[model samples]
Target: MTMTNTAPAPTVWATLQANDAPALIDFLVNTFGFIKTAAYADGDQVAHAQLDWPEGGGIMLGSYKPDQEWSRRPGTAGMYVVTADPDALYAKVRAAGADIFRPITDQDYGNREFGVRDPEGNLWSFGHYRGEPHP
Candidate 1:
């Protein structure tokens, strides 16, 4: 069965923990076109950060803290981002020297997509799929 939502705005966000939160934020903003909305940090460790995708939605991330109750392991996140122009974004990502694990191609599901790894080792897939319509 397929599930759908009719919410007016996005209420869910993808989150991750990075070994170097600041650098990761920079890479995401510069390489993937994510907008750096906010970041709270203490010295070299980031407490929180928000990066918004221009098309829609965003993500929250912070430094990897093993002792914290909500601690998450770094380099283990995999996110799929929806874009309107995967081909253009793919070219830009490649120009930035990002590690491309999958070349851009047309999928049988009717989406054009590609995959890349960030400097922090997080996997990111960009595509033109917007998902099914809300019911």
Candidate 2:
């Protein structure tokens, strides 16, 4: 017996906490080209925000409030994003003053990749690697 799936693969989403959400949003949009999808505020402070990538998927974020019951340390996330042009993205990220952790280079696994840190210090990596079973 054989089975066939018909639904599109679910997209993976990540969350980030920021010390200054508005500033972070500006950095993401201007430097990384992420589009602001939604942003909620509480008394002039961003309560929550959603930024979408043009290619697909996105990341959620919020300003950290010490009084909040649920909050994580800002700048403690490491994320990998797949892109069609790592070299071009790397150039943009570099020109935007992103702190590069690793220069763009080819991997033995057949990926061209680069790593950098966002303004808030979240580790971000971009690559052409699609991982396994993504053909």
On residues 34-106, what C-alpha lDDT tens digit does candidate 2 reach at each position? 8999999885588889998766678988998777777878989998888899989999999988899999999
Computed on alpha carbons, the lDDT of every model, listed in order, comes to: 0.93, 0.86
lDDT score of residue 21 within candidate 1: 92
Which ranges in model 1 have alpha carbons more than 4 Å from their true place? Answer: 1-7
So what's the TM-score on candidate 2?
0.86
Models 1 onward score TM values of 0.92, 0.86
The sequence of per-residue lDDT tens digits that candidate 1 reaches over residues 37-125 is 89999988999999989888999999999999998799988999999999999999999999999999999999999999998888999
